[model samples]
Target: MQIADRIEQALDRAVALAQGPGAPPLLASALRYAVFPAGHRIRPQLCLAVAGACGDADPESADAAAAAIELLHCASLVHDDLPCFDDSALRRGKASVHAEYGAPLAVLTGDALIVHAFATLRPVAARDPSRMATLLGIVTEAVGSPGGIVAGQAWECEVAVPLADYQRAKTGALFVAATRAGAAAAGVDAEPWRMLGDKLGEAYQVADDLRDVLCDSDELGKPIGQDAVRLRPNAAAQLGVGGAKARLEDLVRAAVESIPDCPGAADLRMLIKAQTALFFPKQLAREAA
Candidate 1:
């Protein structure tokens, strides 16, 4: 099966298991709204790729991990769009969960997706309990703890926060988890592939920052300039648009260079590098003569 089809099926199964038995009607709807027609299952796809490149090509084995990371990503979006955070009205070209479902359900939706992520891992539970446990732990830490995405958001509220630290948690945490967990699912050490994940995430954030400036609402599927309007410290805000673009290129090259000598690592790295080319040229075209 195509990787996209496989990832979608895995997502379906994961959400199904999460909705088992006593799901609240509103929460179920909220969860569904948050996940379906997902803008880009980017993190999950990267997870599957990293695992396969790291040497576990079964795809099915990596499915649970992919779904797990994507679920958490969905959960994060549900909360991030609340009035308290980005106050976003649209995401992936539709009303955001909170905008459509109400704040209470939005909270429940995020929480449900988080719990569902763990539940989805049951299929791989027996294959590698230690790795599963490690993955679960990593996911939890990446979500909302002192150094997690939640904290990353909270840090923005503080008087001062180190840009690098915020960047790692807010954007890089889930990505790092995606790559590391993929390695764990394949029963391999995650260290060698961690840098690759960081590079992809850094490039993602830089492009995201650029999109916040260069891309239009219709193109981005959401409001543009939310970062500047909200005073969110982004690469562009911190480093001018030109600097941010350069930073993105730097990250893309580093990510590709970080790949280890495994037979599949180079291709995996190139796949990630391709993403930079995808976003950069589009942004350039928008400003061209």
Candidate 2:
């Protein structure tokens, strides 16, 4: 609740700024529509969880990083659902930004949210220049080239999209940033925690793959089976349903094992386990059984 509250407040403030008297009403509303009511908030929660495990040297800065990661995530979803991309009409049980506010505004709204993501970090940068710089790089790289979300999205356009690369960039990059930035915010070396985030992120993507195949729109709070509809690369398609479930289980185990030695290692491990249960829902397990 604390983490969610912080995110809500920050998003509200950002949207409020964009809702100035001269601001377009629907655009401002669309921004709020895309962010609010929140999803699982898993990335930001992981960020806060990692910071807590790492000692939380600066709570305020840690909060900022979590907020920034979420903003970037929301921005990605908005852009991802545009007509040019996934063409998803629903998000979090509501109309997608593009569906609700038209495509052009959706594009600008996504762009504005990306800018807000960085702006959200400025206060942290002012408080600790080093941490700020590190976080800036972490977030930028997570959403940018080589192995970022952008690259991940681009893989869909490729004639031959590598499964590992696409999954990592499209989903894992932000998760990596979450854990690494959390550790960085807490004045620790973020490298040891990198694999934990990667494994978790991979697990997340696999779970999503299963969900898209096994679930329905009402259950998922969004459109399901989009990968097949769009002909995009998906684990369930590449590996088959059983194989994807096995892969998801393997990633979950690896994620739990990858937690490095830290002051709160035990708690972090437990956190990973609890989160894993959510990823591998009881229905999934039962259906497989």
Candidate 3:
């Protein structure tokens, strides 16, 4: 099966399990709403890609890891769009979880997804306890406090924060987890893949910064100029449009170069380049040109 299909199947199965008998009806619906019609699915795709590049000895484990990453990502989005954060009403061209399901349900949905992410890995543990432990540690560190996505979000509340630190925590953490967990899922050394994830994650955040500034709500399916409105640190605002675009290009190149030698390295490089090309907004491309 294709990578995309695999991801969808895993996610669908997860959501189905969550919706089993005795489940709360509205909360279940909210969970589906938060996850379905995925936005990019970049993190999960990267996880599976790195797993494939590493030979994917355990395809089932890789699928679980990918689905877990995506679930956490979806959870983050649900929380990020709440009134306390970006207050975004639209996501992926549809009403956001909080907007469609109300704040209480949205909060529950995000929390449930977070728990479900860990639960998704349970079967892996039964099969290979050691591999499951490694994957759990990777995923946990990416979303937990001190250096994870949670820290990234907490930084927004602090009096002062470094841009790079914030970006790495808020965005890069999961990407790092994705790449590292991918290798672990395949029973390979995961450390070597961290650089690729770091570069790609930062690049993705920079691209997001550019999109927030240059793209309309209709184009991005989310609020625009939020960085300026919220005074959040933004690469585009820190670096000029041209400079941010240049930075993104540099990161993409670095990410591709960072791919370790493996059977699928060449193909992975091509895929990375192709995927990142879509990151540039048409207007940004025109301006850069």
Candidate 4:
């Protein structure tokens, strides 16, 4: 199956599993709304791609990992668009979960998706306990505690912070999980893939920063100028558009070079190149002109 189809299937299965006889109808609908029509699917694609590059011995486990990562990502988005956070009405060009279903249901939906993410790994654990344990550790670390994405969100509520720390925690943590867990899912040492995820995550955030400034809500499928409105730390704000573009290019280069020597290295490099085009389409257009 195509990677996109695999991701959607895994996600669909997860939501199906979440729906029990006693589960509320509204919550189930909200969960579906939050996760469907995915935007980019970058984290899951990164997970699947890294797994393939590492010679995935068990495609099932990798699929679960990819789906779980994406579930967590969707959970983040649902919460991120809440009134307490970005207050975004549109997501993926549709009303955000909260906007469509109200704040209480959105919260429940995000919470349910997060629970379902860990649940998605249970079958994998029965098959390969060690690999499943490692995946869990990697994912929990990315989503929880002192330096995870949750901490990334917490940073926004703080008084003062370094931009790098904030950016890495908010955006890079899950990416680190995606690449590292991909390797771990393949029963390999995950350490080597960390840098690639880190650099790629940073590049993606920079690109998002640029898009927030340069693109309209229609182009982004969400609110524009959010960083400025929210006073969020943004690369474009700190370094200006040209400098942020330069930073994004440098980070993508670093990400590609950081790929370890494997038989699939060429394919992995091409994958990164393709994703870089997604990250900096405007820059590519400018250069072509």
Candidate 5:
């Protein structure tokens, strides 16, 4: 099956598992709403791609890892759009979880998705108990304290924060986790893939920064100028449009170059090039050209 199909199916099963009898209907609906109609599914796609590049000896485990990564990402988005954060009304061109389901349900939905992300991996332990520790560790670190997405979010609350540190934790953590987790799921050495994730994740954040400044809400499906409004770190604001675009291009090149030597390296490189190319908004691309 295609990567997107695999991700959706795994996610559907994970959501279904959470929606058993006696579950709160609103929370269940919120869970479904938060995950469905995924935006790009890029993180999961990267996970699966890295797994494929690494031989994908355990496709089932990789799928679960991918699903878990995506669930965490979705959960982050749910929380990120809450009133306390970006207060975004729309996500993926529709009402955000908090907007559509209300903050209480939205909070529950994000929490539930985080739990379900770990739950989705339970079957993997049954299939190959040996892989559980590594998988759990990788996923946990990506979303947990000191250096995970949670830390990334926490940075926003701090009195002072470094831009690179904030960006890495907030955005790059999961990408690093995705790449590392893919290799771990495939029973390969995951360390070598970290650089690729780091570069790509930073590139993605820079792209988002540029988009925030250049694109309107209608184009991005979320609030624009949020960086300025919230005084959040933004590469576009820090580096000018031209400088940020150059930085983005450099990161993309670095990411492609960082791919570990594996069977699918060439294809992976092509995929990175193509996907990162889309990071440039049409207007930015035109101006750059």
Candidate 6:
């Protein structure tokens, strides 16, 4: 099967697993609503690709890792759409969970997805329970606590939080987790492979910041100008749009360079290229007129 097709299959199965069979009708409905017709599932796709490049990727455990990480991502999006947060009514070009299911159900669906992420990991956990436990701990830490995405969100409330800290927590954490989880799933235990997570995570953050400035809401499928509208600090705010795009290119180059260029990293190199291609001058093509 083609690589993208394989990733899509894993994503579809994850959407189903997140729903499960015995969930309450309300919960099942929420699950279907939150995940179906979702975004690209890029996080899990990145994980699977990295795993495959590195080694066998052990089909048995790779799906578990993909499904678990996807649930985590879906949960984050559900919470992100809450009234207290982005407070948006649209996601992926459709009404968000709260908009369609009501606030209470939306909250529960987010909570449930978080729990299911770990639950989905049980099979891989069985392969070597202790290692799985460690992986879960890393994922949980990234999603919660003082230095994670939850904390990243909380920073907006703070009187003085570093922009780098906020961006890393909010965007970079998941990229880091995806790579780490992929390495674990592949049963590879090298420091270099593990470190790929951090590099990719930071690279993605830079790319996202560039997009928020250059891309329109119609293209992004989320509210546009959110950072500028909210007066939040962004790469575009600190560095000009032209400069932010440059930073993105630099980071992508750095991220790809951090990993040893080899047969294993060939596809990963392509993935990085595809991501950075959209960031700059085209953004001002019309404005230049």
Stretches of candidate 5 exceeding 4 Å from the true structure: none
* Candidate 6 C-alpha lDDT tens digits along 6-84: 6667656666776677768888888877877657777777778777777845765666777777777778788888998
The residue-by-residue lDDT of candidate 4 on 164-256, one tens digit each, is 998898999889999998898888899999999899989989989989888888878899998888888999999988788889889989999
Q: What global local distance difference test value does model 6 have?
A: 0.72
Error of 5 at 10 (Å): 0.9
Residue range 91-126, candidate 2, lDDT tens digits: 889899999889999999998888888888888866
- Give residue 138's error in model 4 in angstroms: 0.4
The list of candidate 6 runs beyond 4 A from truth reads: 260-263, 278-289
TM-score for each prediction? 0.93, 0.95, 0.98, 0.97, 0.98, 0.88
lDDT of 2 at 133: 92
The candidates, ranked best first by TM-score, are 5, 3, 4, 2, 1, 6
Q: What is the C-alpha RMSD of each candidate to the true structure, in Å?
A: 2.0, 1.7, 1.0, 1.2, 0.9, 2.8
What lDDT tens digits, residue by residue, belong to model 5 across residues 102-132? 9988999999999999999998898788798
Name the lDDT value of residue 107 in candidate 6: 94
RMSD of 5: 0.9
Screening candidate 6 with a backbone cut-off below 3 angstroms (N, C-alpha, C), the clashing residue pairs are none
Residue-wise C-alpha lDDT for candidate 1, range 52-147, written one tens digit per residue: 787784455588888888988888888888998888999999999999989988988898888888888776667767776877776777677776
Worst 10 residues of 2 by lDDT: 6-15
| Residue-level error in angstroms, candidate 1, position 187 | 1.7
Better of 1 and 3 by lDDT: 3
**What stretches of model 3 exceed 4 Å from their correct place?**
287-289
Q: Whole-model lDDT for model 3 versus the true structure?
A: 0.93
Global lDDT of each model?
0.80, 0.87, 0.93, 0.89, 0.93, 0.72
> Which should have the higher TM-score, number 2 or number 3?
3
